[model samples]
Target: MRDRIKTDELLSTSDLRVSTAATAWRHVEAEYVDEIDGILATLAPSGPYAYTVSPRMEEGKEIPTQRIVTTFDEIAETYQNLHRFAAVVAIRPVTQLHASWYTFVSGLGRGREKATGQESERPVIVLFPTMGSEGITGELFWGRTQRDSMPGDPADGSLASRFAVAKVHDTLLDAYRSGDVDALTDLAHAEIQAGLRDYEADTGTLAEMHTREELRRHLERFFGRYRVLGIDVVTSHYDDWFFFHELRWTVESRTGDDAGQTYRYHTAEYAELSAEGKIVAHIGHGTDRISAACPGPA
Candidate 1:
């Protein structure tokens, strides 16, 4: 059987680079740069560029791993070669604008169908921008087109509100990535609490606690055990509240029999956010498997 490695043993500078590249590849494919450029001509005059990291795959594994180094470099070269005039943007995940567009559309449809009687007949449409599109005109143009395509209804205002919530979600993720623990604590609502509770439970811990001190202590301990090698926001959704696409760090104990091994794990978390963009509750689910890597000491 293959070895089950711990995260701490394997996250090196090379690992970080590979992970970043792989994520960039995913963004390039999903956005379809060709189509994005066409859309940008209308909404943004500046050119846009994007790339994704190529996920790593084992020699005999059925499914490919998320170590996409090759893909990232390839996409970067492709962008530079094809769009000479447009600034070849550095590879990154889909922008907050894209996330807001997705959340708004998904929630709008669900909300319209849920209203009862007259309210049911009168659906709402919302328009919200999570980020300014100075770099990616194509994304901005596509976003506007998608927003305008929504059916006209009274709930338009409500859709706008949903966009506001998405903005909050994006902001919170940014703060968390920047290591702003205090900012994260202040922004977290029930959804974030719920998400952390789910994380604690999955890792085998206690119940939900509201105090910032408790959370800080818990996070400190967690980080000590497993360093945060990387974080990627893959997708997001908002119903009455907001949800996030979070990729976090996981590590294994290095003492005892299982020593000197490393692995990478992926997780998907659903969260409920407050009006101010704090996470109140969250549920996480995903497969926990060891990733392939070079042999090394723990």
Candidate 2:
């Protein structure tokens, strides 16, 4: 029996993080600090690359502020810090989110904080995508997240095949991009549920839809407001039960106060699929700072 079963079959978990877009991030962070130059070379062009973190705030009602570090020089300075080299622990691969984009949560020790005897653990989120020859280009976020669960065993043999998940996902994306409501109806189950958790919104609302009819209405409202310029799947991961993908979208507002303005958004979504390969549940979250509004094409 052992000889007949494949090596992966013996493992209880289905984490493909080592093979996903997170590979370069894991490599760079795990290597000796002196190897930073070679690792930085793996990042995408420096102009667009960014590293951001949530500002430290006192325990209270004060809202957190964002501090972004751009430019290769600034990014290098942060990575070269001695404390930045601390070992990463408790890594959890967040799947079923971005199409081709992927992210993981891990803990890194912050060097000497106040009078603490030992380094304090800070949660870090490493978000990345495979950019052609750039390999794994990532945006490292420190102190943005406070908690995450550890990795777990794979689904109990109930997961769908990669091919099945990818096929439906591609069709759905095409339909969405084209505003093909009929095609979308064919792809969604009668009991479909969908929602968007727009983190960029000040209200922090998770807008939801419970049935195909509700989804249709929601999509109609969305299409009415914005004309999708493009949607590029940056990276993705899937199993029998869930398909996770990160996508970058460019759209122009058609009906709001911001009409005639274009914006670029980075979003992640995870969809739960039924046995028949139809989407039963879909949840999405906005992942990045939206680009400044620009004039739409004439």
Candidate 3:
């Protein structure tokens, strides 16, 4: 039988300190010590690895010690030290791994601090899966962790994927807000069709708004009546065939007569997209609730 594993499980936690060490090595050659030093500074405050040492002295001689005076100075000194030890660097990879692991551990630490209402440290290390080990790697790690711990689905979806979706949503919202009808059309999917049908029915304009032109005209008229202040996403979820969002909109009437009337509305939008991320359908629930006021006719 094939080994059964749930994809939602987090695999191995990354060591942020090790990850930082690896990052430092990757960019060590350049004058980007300031940047590398920033990475190191994130490791646990007051930890042993926080200091920088000079290159090893001659054999049987006391190793010369150099306290890293300034943050930039420390980075410069550490870079030189790394160069000197480059030949005998057996556990460099281990350093990187530890850095990566520390990242995760550090984040957990922060969460704990927040729960207890502790002051947050600057340059706090936080763990995030590297590009290579994100979705699948995290799933595997979580799966293994679950095997030893309690049972439950690990967080579904990779952080990168979720961030990508967020970007997509943001881009679409920008298009909509800017009245970039073409861009909006490009991003729309089948969900838009379903949404339009509902809108037409609810607004009692079913027969009049049939074609894309008619729909665009109607939207222009409707949206033209309001100045959108913001569109905030409330939630997003997806299954095999569809993705949807719960969105909140803040808008003020554009009509001179209703100039001061601002509204906050909730919408439930469903989207269907093409393989390239173009939206094919955009469907939703929109209810306008008065939220603010500007000077206008009652």
Clashes of each: 44, 17, 42
* Per-residue lDDT over 1-298 for candidate 2, one digit per residue giving the tens place of the 0 to 100 score: 6764665653422344434544555445544334667556766663444444333444652223334454667766765663353433334444323223344433343434323445455433344543322444445443422122212224523332656677788898898788788888788767665555433232232455656797787777777777877888876766545566777788777765767777776766667666666676665445443655654432
| lDDT digits (tens) for residues 53-87 of candidate 1 | 22234586422222111122344454444344332
Ranking of models by TM-score: 2, 3, 1
Model 3, 103-161: lDDT tens digits are 12111111112234343211111122222221101100000000111111235344433
- Which stretches of candidate 3 lie above 4 Å from their native place? 1-166, 189-192, 196-211, 238-241, 293-298
Provide the lDDT at 136 for model 2: 48
Per-candidate RMSD, Å? 18.7, 13.4, 24.0
Q: RMSD to the native, candidate 3?
A: 24.0
Model 3 TM-score? 0.38
True-vs-predicted CA distance for residue 157, candidate 3, Å: 9.9
Write down the worst ten-residue block by lDDT for model 3: 137-146
TM-score, per-candidate, Cα-based = 0.37, 0.46, 0.38
- Per-residue lDDT of 209 in model 1: 39
